[model samples]
Target: MIEKCSGNTLKEEFEDVFDDVLIDIGPLSVYYPPGCINRQVSEQSRKKKILRNNYLIKRNQLVLVRGASGSGKSTLLSLIKGIIPDSIFAVIEGRFQFVEPSANVFCVFQNPYSQLVCPTVKEDLVFTMENRGFSQRKMAERLTQFSNFFNLFHLLENKTSKISGGECQKIVLASSLAADPTVLLLDEPTAFLDKDARDEFYAYLAKLKGKYTIIIVDHHQEQILSLADQVIDLDVGIDIDLGKKREHTLVSENWGMIRGAIQENYCICIDKLSFSYAKDAKTQSNFCLKDLNLNIESGKIVTILGQNGSGKSTLLKLISGVLRPTAGNIVIKQGCHPLAPKEYCRHICYLMQNPESHFLFDSIAEEIEFNYRKRGDRSGNISEIFGYYFNVDIDVDVDLSRSPLLLSEGEKRRLTFLMAVLEEKGIMLYDEPTFGQDDASCKKIVTLMKKLREHNRLQIIITHDEKMAYSISDIVYRLCQGRLIDEC
Candidate 1:
């Protein structure tokens, strides 16, 4: 049975469990200094921050932490991992366990591409094993096993630069699992995948149920709710609770009549589209997409589904004008015009699956205002919007100069969404918008999409969540072998 203990007793217990390798933080508090003019700043004037108040993570449990964007989830993780500096953030009271100096702990970051730093897949996997003093034969055996298990064998000899996002993500998973860590922390591992690939990925994870201590921060609620042994809700600040299963029913009124309006207006059209990436001298060239014809209308949520490398995101890029088709023309009806890549930025906002890259400001407040200013728009009543949408009060008097990069993963995602909304674009393309959120946050996102649709905005979402696709979309399309097939 799980028991809550006082801070001092918990620290002592953690040290005993971890054999003195425990990370202890007492009354920790962090702050960011203001943007100053050539002078050092005082602690009192800095922005105050608090990660957790007397928090404790139990050993060897499949724990899932759920929180909205910018709720300090990532910071908490860093604190537990002993990566954050004591001087910056004050640890109110907490202790984290690590068995030994070489204790097994692996963290899969939100962006799989960022984690890949080696030349080739083999070299990347072997590098870690080699550093751990594993023999060549043993390393090779483990590499083969992991690669085969994750279906990454096909890309073993290929350059890391040439793999698709899904393939790259699988490689990261293989690398993390190859280490055979006692605890595995996953941050939105299936964010970049299509429906089939996401299903396969989750199946692989389900097989590892009791083998390791798993902690996943995810936004795909329906997929993980049944599997989660415990769900720590962080909606407010540091509210942890056990997960209880509840039956979910479809809300017919949730989607509203926006879909019917989209069918009447032909906003976007594609004719026989095809695209291919350049191939290396040693390998055969491959077509990412071929002979795809589709049309998207305003007010409708169109979902494109497929497996990994099936051109789902490529299709979204084609529609959003980020990519040009090698062989077909994209035609916009009279009311809409085909925008160039740069012009598309102003008209078509693409919310990337990985929200970390979307941040451009130092703080969440600044990030929102930056987007507002970019669009030449002003929100005189910012408090109303924040209260209605974010459920947070904005301190207009306080200067928000902290870096957005320091926010939690969920917060980053929310900030990105806010940025897109502030753009007031005619068409919005969301590539896996719900990556690292909880059940409540996921519902809020759906509600936000509905609000946008009611305003007559053309919203196209690329998602792996079949339930979400069916719930919000007016039309659904499937991509297979680089071809688009409509699902009636």
Candidate 2:
């Protein structure tokens, strides 16, 4: 049976489970520049924004922090966990507690790619334990246990970069578990997994529950609600409370007519496309995708699904005019197409899988407004447009002189998406738009997609979330071994 405990009681019990283990934080604040740019000028002018006040977390209790995309949820987690420098844009107003001696903490980021520092899976696991001075025997034993637990035994010797995103996620968790930390924090752990992989991953977590004080920052509530002991809602600033069951109504409406029906013109057409990246020096013949022919209709939602390295991203790049096809020609309707790839960016926006790469401005506000002004359209104010689309307030007076790189991962992604959407581009390409978001943020993204479709814009999203793909897509396509297979 599930037992509900108060925050104070939970904290006490947690400290008792792992003696001297506690996480204490006084008031903390984080700041970002005025625009979402990564340059030094923007970074220097970014101002601190208060994130948490008087926040304290004890051991054993599972804490789930929910908020919008840029709501500083991950920033708070980073501050509490000591991931970034205190002297940076973040300022701490109070002290924090973590047990000395036996206290160990591990954090798994939302993007598994960023967490991987080693070349091979087995080496990655061993590296962490080695750093902690674990005996060789103990490290091997722990590796075996973790590999068995996550069904990653086959991936032990595989190149970490060659593994699927889902498998990489499991590897990150395994590496973290091998550290034997008393406190484990997972940031959007299931963002990259397929349905089956997600189920299996969570099942493993269920078995390991109560053994570690787990704090998960995630957006997939349906999968996590029953498992979470306590949920912290961060809708407003610094107000934490218990979670309640929330029911969401699934609204069904034809999104095709949002832009007043699709025109007969072909927006993007690809014929016999192919691409490959060398796996190793010995195998110069390896290819990722082959013979991909697809057509993108005007003002419709199209989704592409595939396991990692199935060329979904490669296909997206080709469509967005980022990558040149080695064998095929991509033709756009003559009158409606941009003259070149650089110019094509004006008409087609591609939200890369890595959000940090797209940030070219300093502050979140400036990032949003820059795209608006760049489009040469004075149709709407940046604050009002993003506020209405995302259902979140954006204070115009807030500083727009900070660095975008200083924001949390989720914030960077949201800002990237907002910039793309506000650009009013005709064709928007989203590569895993829900990568590191929580449920609320995911819903807001869906809302934004619907709004764009209402304006008769074309959207193509590459994702593994079946629920999201089905919910927002008008058509779905699957890619396997670099081939496009239609799933009508």
Candidate 3:
């Protein structure tokens, strides 16, 4: 049962028996960059209203939060986790009461890297339990339970730096769950997971549904909706068609001719390539990739699908010259010889799984301008180009001056993708390009890939989203146990 009060009365009640209820709220509103009320009316454009007129969250409720990118879904999770107003700098209005002693809440942020503090997977899994003063025996028991369920035994001693993004996400989820929090907030928790791993997580979450109060924000609505007891939609009232599908009819005529001409020139060639981190890293010691051979031509989009830590991302790094091969060579652009790292990078744009690593500037506008300056291409204004591709007014849908760090995970992915492919690079390597994106944003990326193909750019994508891979890719390959297992 929910205990509700209005105005100041709610505040007085909160001081007393707050711990008796999971969450009780009166009328509430949230604004960013605090003191938004004090700013001039004209400066309304500068401030962001994060949430308004919130409702109560009862004990043992599974709440699904739905909204477009940059619609404050993550912000709401932060508020519930009691991290806002202190760590996140937001102004609050009205009153909301949580279970007394706020440490009972746990949050799995969209980016797994932010929460990882330990160097190795084993230590990271036990980090929260140590902080919470759990008994050593209990920590060991919980670790075994979670590690078995997540199939993370092989990665227990692995350095966090050497693992894949999906593996990191599993570690974070396991670490958080081992802490035994009363309230759990998940922000796209399964975004980086492969099919089997995602299903495992869903099964565990379903078993935990009524045991703890859960609030999740995710764009993968089909499965999540089945577990949701209630739905909260954050309406920003801006209708942006960022996900519109490309007109296949328009490109059907020219695609075959373009492919035939481009096939005459191979953009990237990998011959008997192999990679290993065994000596340097203390885990996954059987060599990450082995004897891999692949050839991709210009004007082609190839997708690599694999389970977590199956050397898919490692393949991308090898091709982009981020990691040197143990044996064999990678030849680029019909060249007889392999290119040096610097020369290889000049013709490549690699978008890593974590988009935050790509940002050097504070604001979106600054990042875009910096990319423009670096490329020495003033052929088009980025703002205009962005507006055209995304079908949204940049000033309204996205705040150009706001820190790129503040944008939602989906927004960050889009922004970095634009920065990567906007230039005239011959090869584009994307690792999990569509993770965290909504349908519209996903379509926009696919459409952009189609457009880039017309220009004869070679695109190799690593993804767990098989449906999306089939939709956009000219060829699909599956990696397993450090080898190319299948192709379609």
The TM-score values for the models, in the order shown, are 0.77, 0.75, 0.81
Q: What digit string (tens of lDDT, one per residue) describes model 3 on residues 91-171?
A: 665556674555478889987766788999999999988888999999999999989988889999999887767788899
Error of 1 at 6 (Å): 4.7
Q: What lDDT is obtained when candidate 1 is compared to the true structure?
A: 0.64
Off by over 4 Å in 3: 1-21, 24-28, 34-47, 50-54, 99-103, 118-120, 131-133, 157-163, 237-266, 278-285, 334-342, 373-397
TM-score (C-alpha) between model 2 and the true structure: 0.75
Every candidate's lDDT = 0.64, 0.67, 0.73
Model 2 score (lDDT): 0.67
Which tens-of-lDDT digit does each residue in 1-488 have in candidate 2? 11122234334555556453466544443444334334554435433333334445556767777765555566666765665434334333334445442557778877787678899999987776777788989998999998898788888889987887778888888888898878888888888876667888788777777778888887777778778776655433321211222111111122221323334333777788766655342332465767777777666799998875567888888877778766667776534653565677657788988888987665666776776677464667766654554444333222344567765576567768767755656788899887776565677778778777766677899998878888988889888766778887
Worst 10 residues of 3 by lDDT: 244-253
> What lDDT tens digits, residue by residue, belong to model 1 across residues 351-458?
887777787655656676676666454555544544444333334222234465654566567668767876677788988777666566667678878877877778
Instruction: Please tell me which model should have the higher TM-score, number 2 or number 3.
Output: 3
**Candidate 1 vs. true structure, TM-score:** 0.77
The lDDT-based order of candidates, best leading, equals 3, 2, 1
- Give the Å error, residue 98, model 3: 2.8
Which TM-score value belongs to model 3?
0.81
